[model samples]
Target: MKKSTKMMFFTMMIIGTMITMSSNSWMSMWMGLEVNMMSFIPLIYKMKNNKSAESSMIYFLTQSMSSMLMLFSISMNSMMENKMMILLTISLMIKMGAAPFQMWFTEMMNKMSWMNCLILMTWQKMAPMFICQMSQEKFLMSSALSTMVGAIGGLNQTSTRKIMAFSSINHMGWMMMCTTFNNNLWIMYLLIYSTLMMPLAWMFNEKMIMHSSQMMTNMKSMTEKMNITCMMMSMGGMPPMLGFLPKWMAINSMMESNMYMIMIMMIMMSIITLFYYMRITMSTMMIYEVQKKWMMINQNKNMYTSIMLTMNLLLMTMMMFF
Candidate 1:
């Protein structure tokens, strides 16, 4: 694609998200989602390979079906408000790829470029999830199901992208739970989730890492390995890391709301997710028998990694003080 074309599509995505965020009416929100889908489809299609084309087609079909359902529900809500609300909720759930609706999400992650995966996992979630928050619907069953599916689905995956996709679903569950009690907490969770995800995505793109098996073979130095391990652990929301803060806050809020059963289920599922993360971390640290390859580390990349690690540590300490 041409530079100008890419720029245009990127701008459209941003504008579309802004429209969704600012829109008070369901009609405008739905329109914004359509704009986002249209802009993003081109970005997903690649001339070099048919995989991107296939992924884009799947994405388009899914979004179109969801949009149709949403439109129908909106039109019919006057006749049966409660039933229409449930239909509308399901439509948004499908759009966001919350569990049971998540098969397309994992497939797309496997086929997409790292940049596209990042957008799918993070930016693409904002509109639908925000809509879910605004709807104030009871999504307890969906939230729990998504959490369990994300945790269990990722346990056997070797693909790094698929693992992250499941992780995103798990976080979506947490975000959904947050929406039940407070919108402000949902915003905070999203912010922290995106912040922690950006560095990991950047690392994956920089290294061209696609699988968990490659970590032990590809990483050069102990420092690099350690940084990646810590980052992954942090992303898993391990205690004493910056990632833990949001989950901690979320659990606290849930407890205050007398949501004990759901809170317990979420914590258990999170532990399962963290177990896989630990497996990845241990693989990086323990299996270091590959022929040593002296790959020159880029200074800027090193600086960025250092800054991120330092900030995480600093924040962890600051939280401890409070």
Candidate 2:
């Protein structure tokens, strides 16, 4: 965990993702993915912790299996068999941790540092997802299953990281759907997803919050509570929020394609996800006190936190004028 070592791995991550994004050949793409996987495993290891070690090992096994399958599928592409293409799609799905292939994802999140979790949730997905996009295979069934599984899986979880992991899986479904239809929409969804997630991740890291209950107990001021509530609500894709914009566009696209059933299912599952966010928000609101002692004691006024929260909360309103 030396500073130099971290930088080296970080550089590898950037290079790997760039290579995958730019590569025209499947072999080069697979090489970039291997580089990404190898670089990330070291970053997952925390000092003197068996859990991180175990998590990293599991991650390596899963990713390596998927990489091999990808290579095999590529090798067999000349046969023009449907089964080979299906295997390729499944390999990318596993690499991206889409649901049904998502068993490793939450466990890995639980053991990783918040920084590593951020990278896992966001940057690590880029290469495989881009591969998925390019494959152009029909995976609507997988997309629906991912969204449904993500929604139901998080409903009973108290752990914040696990919930976010499920949320990521759910978003992956939407991303897959968009990628299947329009590349531009997929990119827009990703940008917005990352934008909403950054503030939430930063807040959790700053407060060391690991559960929904912690938010209710740890926040001291009305402002902190409100900010947290607003942020979570927006992230849940409530109407008039920045997060809703992408979903709105997605629904419109789905409708145009006559995908009514899939559209309905996605909307319903999203409502279930929002219900949990509201539950957490309500818990915090009900416990908030107006007493002087509760007035902004040791408020986190970190510049980055303030800026991200402000942008997340107000960006939708700003967009209204244009």
Candidate 3:
């Protein structure tokens, strides 16, 4: 019964995002966000972590406030076009956990399970981010700020989920920047980001790894460690890996558009972001720790893991042409 109920909410949550994505009007989009919030609040609860209850509450209040602001802006559209657009953009920014409005997001992520954190980082942002993309000028300042905050904020983090949360904010910065070039770039960015996140989240969930320290201690399998470390590098936009492709395209687009100041700032911030990713790998890379019996005993490659890792390489190839 518990599992079935969770699945039901999960399906509804996906449907809610679809509704907003497909909506032709502002009011309908707001309605979809409401549906999304209603469904998501239930899914945040976990048997082991009572912190999820508080996380869900904060998430609810934050999302509801955004929704109210959006609906008001939508309703008053005829009377105030410029002001309403600003209002609506702010609402969406709040919804997507972009910085300056991101306090609740990291807290919630810290409390939630890896699966819930994955959904919060990826799927839940799609609708609000899609709406925010429509307003390019307003999006720029927020995008820049997010990049800066995400880079600096992640530096001291030990919690793996919190690190990923900040990473999501950083990528949100990049994806928002992509919108200025056009819509397709951000969509491509989201798809690629989602692909890279799955295996990392699964690894954390499987090993119950929470902190940066645990990446070395808890993950006993070399294959698991190697795959995760490489994925982290790819995510940080190391060249030749899949994650770098979108950043590469975004930078090229910015250059073509003559966005020199913002481009320099974003590039600097990205290097900072990559540094923490490297820091996370140092534990697994530098150490010659005692091998556990399980490390040598287990040689079976998981079919799902093999497929995901293979897709990582394949995607790098396909996305370049795409």
lDDT of each: 0.87, 0.84, 0.85
Ranking by TM-score: 1, 3, 2
Candidate 2 lDDT, tens digit per residue, 1-322? 7999989999998899999999999999999999999998888884549988998999999999999999999999889778788989989999989979999998988877777888898888888888888887867988899899888998999988988899888888988888878457888888888877887788788878888888876676767777777778877889777788888878988998999999999999988888888888898899866456745555464654576557755675657753
Overlapping backbone residue pairs in candidate 3 total 0
Each prediction's total of clashing residue pairs, residues at least 3 apart in sequence or on different chains, is 0, 0, 0
> In terms of lDDT, which candidate is strongest?
1
lDDT of 1 by residue, 1-322 (tens): 9989999998999899989999998999999999999999999994558889899999999999999999999889779999889989989999999988999999999999888999998899899988888888978999999999999999999999999999999999998888888468888888878878887888788778999988887676666677788778877889788788889998998889899998999999999999999998897899654554565554555666775767577676759775
Worst 10 residues of 1 by lDDT: 289-298
Q: What is the clash tally of candidate 1?
A: 0
Which residue pairs show backbone clashes in model 2?
none
Q: Kindly report which residue pairs in candidate 1 clash with one another.
A: none
List model 3 lDDT by residue over 261-322, tens digit each.
99999989989999999999977776644475655545434744685569666766677676
RMSD of 2: 2.2
Q: Which stretches of candidate 3 lie over 4 Å from their true place?
A: 135-137, 293-295, 299-309, 319-322
Which residue pairs show collisions in model 3? Answer: none
- Candidates 1 and 2 compared by TM-score, better number: 1
Q: lDDT, candidate 3, residue 122?
A: 90
Candidate 1 segments exceeding 4 Å error: 289-301, 317-322
